[model samples]
Target: MQNFLDDNFLLHNDIAEDLFHNYAKSQPIIDYHNHLSPQEVAENKKFENLTQAWLYGDHYKWRAMRANGIDEHYITGQASDKEKFLKWAETVPYTVRNPLYHWTHLELQRYFGITELLSPKTAENIYEQASAQLQAETHSTRDLLQQMNVKVICTTDDPIDSLIHHQTFAQEQSSFQMFPAFRPDKAMQTEQPQVFNTYIDKLAEVSNREISDFQTYLDALKARHDFFATQGCCVSDHGLSHLYADDYTEDEVAQIFQKIRKQELITTEECNKFKSAMLVYFAEWDHEKGWVQQYHVGAFRNTNSRKFNELGADTGWDSIGDFKQGEALVRFLDRLDKENKLAKTILYNLNAVDNDLFAAMTGNFNDGSVVGKIQFGSAWWFHDQLDGMTKQINALSNIGLISRFIGMLTDSRSFLSFPRHEYFRRLLCNIFAEDIQKGLIPNDIPWIGSMIADICYHNAKNYFPFNDSAV
Candidate 1:
């Protein structure tokens, strides 16, 4: 059979094909946000085979298997590699309309030169061939990343991590830059004060200081933030279901932390006060440093406690939250904007109801200093799909200029998922191609191609100055 990756699958749109081959092929990937381990990139680890890379860490497959009534033993349990591949193969035919279908085929075609469809019938041949290539040094972790043209990556890290890998990777690879984001979710773990206190003690030990007071706690976390900065990190990330922006006096906040430290059952109002102050303080610092701050709001995490403990967090146990996110978030951002301390911000929403709200909110703080000083980030996590991407794109376009849009990121734990960018680029090209075909955009190939390149590559480069080349 002929290779599916041959000239035949180049593209349906003549202009799209030309643009990808001519321009997009050479531009390196700037994966600004991801959950990849810096240690793997630093050490340049080699995978055992294709299944370990594709199946071992991919929770997407786990979700699909659970939905198909496959036991956890087959999904991620003690199943052999071939057995896992067999199970995955059996499930593939039913994955139509899911992004996995496109991602699996796209990777096979683009990376492995595979022409045959992946199914129970072709499972053995496909696994054997892919496994063989995986044995070569060319398929090592760093090599895999280079193959995807990844030039820079920012890993989501907690405030407590050592970040030794980030420092080592920086000294070793000038070609690819890996940085850390100072995520302090546990610091705000007010729901579990005991856990929060334990985390604080560990943080204090790491920072080599006593965090007896709230200021000391801030200093300790800020010390790590400064340490992150030395290794070329210019971004901070926060994940919240909604903003906590109620104003509080310094006395009230101090008492709140006192109650937290004392392990007393604090009122919801006290928790809100502490969280609000902490959020404001972080926003102020991020603005002071001229960093890009990301807020991923509207995720209701840890919905199933049993699955959470058995399978651990982020195992498809999170759901869409429906808190009153609008007025509070707008008030918070408005405060920052009023004080001119609102750093370049990116807002991501899980609920589609807030798409228009986020879009309009982004434009509200634009200030006209840059084309995209404020942005509603690409649909993330469960929303990184055709419909989600389209709604987000249309929302941003309707409110602001689509030409200035920054494109997609993996938001994945899997290494092979870099093809997500290709998925996004193709979707973008098709959108533009359809527009041109209908005369909504002119038939000028170069102009439309340039627009496509902007969204896929150049715009993100310009928007985030932390892209390796910018560094």
Candidate 2:
């Protein structure tokens, strides 16, 4: 058998090896969606240790450690950073079949040039070595991104954000570009009246507007959307359990907003109507500004109430949800398509059961206004692994045009996560090579390699409105 993680780790054939090494390996990354801290990038922050860089705020490892019977103290509590990382290293050997196993080693190799597999015996030595490198000037946050050849990153931001860090980064003239993606989920979240009203108050303060009715609220949010555009934002993102398409009149939505402002809990139907209206408004605004809008749906977030109360959201309590997505999604898109206000849209589903549903949904609204105008987004959240990625690619290739597809995003908070793009490109080239070996496709290396290159970098360069001058 071949050595583990050698030069051809994921590459399965001669064609696959050639395709990846030559065409896909060196492409610049376009991380279209991620949760990386703009402040860290702006300040060129350097991590004090490997744990701070790797384990801190990374719920992927936290979940794995918890699965390995690691305590909350060792995972996310007051345990020292080195202790936490030691727990993670102890758990690494047990993660043999998990994607975390591959990712952990991939990160260690890519970032620190460590070829030794991590374990309890070697954790201390590996940690000290990697931590020393992290302290170097060449290993700052910005430098890490440049080391991975990241060209553009779009961070998720709320409507009330100051974006001062983005402004600071813009003035620095770095090699990579960072842009903000407007994520206005809180602006329309009317679930808890107190929380909703509090968010509205913050929005009013940020937009410097008086909010009294639905019209004024929309105006304030619109102003922030305009400000985001001025700050070089060309994308919007929303997270939801599913699409909302409840029919309601403007007056009805206005009444619902008034009830929300008064801190009165609205009925479920009223909440849906208000959210549907807000979604339409956001999509229209995105279209008007020539922005790409993304929807990441079907996550049952914070399922464990006790842990959520202790740790809050996005700490790995979320799971894939089996929500009905077909009819309502069609209604939502058809509503915009009929009005001619549909912007370029990307749809990501957490449930793999909806793979074909999402892939087929793109064909319904791809009105030819743009190439792959309605895209089935990359496999997301729990589905970003090998089986998940392959199934998604196969579904899209069968039902839609994978040629026009924009490729992977880290969707990660760690700087070491850029190797996920490398992972995806290698897997993708292998798939094409396997098909060629089976005589399913012609053996046209240059032509197929060009397609691989486009999927790796060129497609995103052409799709996103980051820099018109980018090659």
Candidate 3:
């Protein structure tokens, strides 16, 4: 009925249209969490073609292409850039009703100003045009970020990282702030002793210490956390199937770590105890330093072992996990809250089923120390789509204060994914507008407009520790 992706593409009414265009659209983006390469941004890397810019490292497209029966070569293998673009274009029309369809065209329209739909018929011409634009100096990595009005980007970095690139960005004082978020999944991975030992050795080397025991290991991690803090990092992230809060004393955890150091197989209970202890230690440090701690849970990753073995992790073989999250998650937070060590926390759940539960969980410890201190983070990963985002916003509004919610993040490796913030803003405004029209809420534009602006940009600006220069 309506023309595709016009100015009012997703806005359903006059109220939605005004809210989006007048308030939400012009807001600067604060991408609080993402997997973007610091080296790429620091070097201002230019892509060779549209394929490199769009296809490479985007597992979302890879998943769609595979569903459309595209082969490995065209998706992630030795195919030429043009070949991959052609394959993706061929698969675009089949993506109708999928969020990728909207994302694909939205990117094309926003970045290249291409209104023509992508298909095999127009693949070559579109690829050549977009690729040519990418080759220009104006389209370099940092330039692309500037074009999207990205104020700050928090890149995921491991505990063992030297953060040399982040240091470089800080020294240069680039237009947009690029800071690292400490992600220490390896530090708590006691189940994989051999691999974890390798990571511990790397941490020890970087920290200039010998980690022969649990306390030393914690010290090494603490040293790196302090280093990250010096570099203006105020966020720590964790990705796990679920949180761990097993009961264990210091002696038990120390013995567990010693067993791991000896490369001995520990029981599942031992693994939980060690992980729980590490989580508490990390939370204490985060609280002490006045940092935000984020937990991204419920991902059943690398399900296709054959594909994972051949191609490696985060190559689109993962799915939402249905793990029992409530008890452990609550216990973990309770432990930190009991000691007054709970830092400003954000919890992101991949499974939609846990939406209401997470919404309720955040309300448990909002001790008025800060507004929305413990937040249910923006709809994440696979749930970053239209319906998923709507559900998350609705649940948060129902059980928590949506006004204080720190809003969207890319959580992506791709530079072009900033438009996802726009998508989220549109959905957010539409929900409020629809409710206002139905007389469920007040029709006060200035007040609601301010709320939209807050969710779009201002909330995160206030929530994060980045200074006035960064915003």
lDDT of 3 by residue, 1-471 (tens): 668999988899999999999999999999989999999998889999999989989999999999999999999899988998999999999999999999999999888888889999999889988889989988899988988999899999998888999988788856789889999998888778898888889888899999989889888999999999999999999999999999999999899988988999899989988889889999999999999999999999999999999999989999999999999999999999998999999999999999999999999999998978999999998899999999999999999999999999999999888889889998898999999999999999999999999989998999888868999
The full ranking of all candidates by TM-score, starting with the best, is 2, 3, 1
User: Which ranges of candidate 2 are over 4 A from the true structure?
Assistant: 469-471
Ranking by lDDT: 2, 3, 1
Model 2: clashing residue pairs?
none
Cα lDDT tens digits, model 1, 309-338, are 898877667878887788987889999999
- For candidate 3, give the lDDT: 0.92
Every model's TM-score:
0.94, 0.99, 0.99
lDDT of 1: 0.81
Model 3 residue pairs with clashes: none
Residue 423's C-alpha lDDT in candidate 2?
A: 88
TM-score, prediction 1? 0.94
lDDT of each: 0.81, 0.94, 0.92
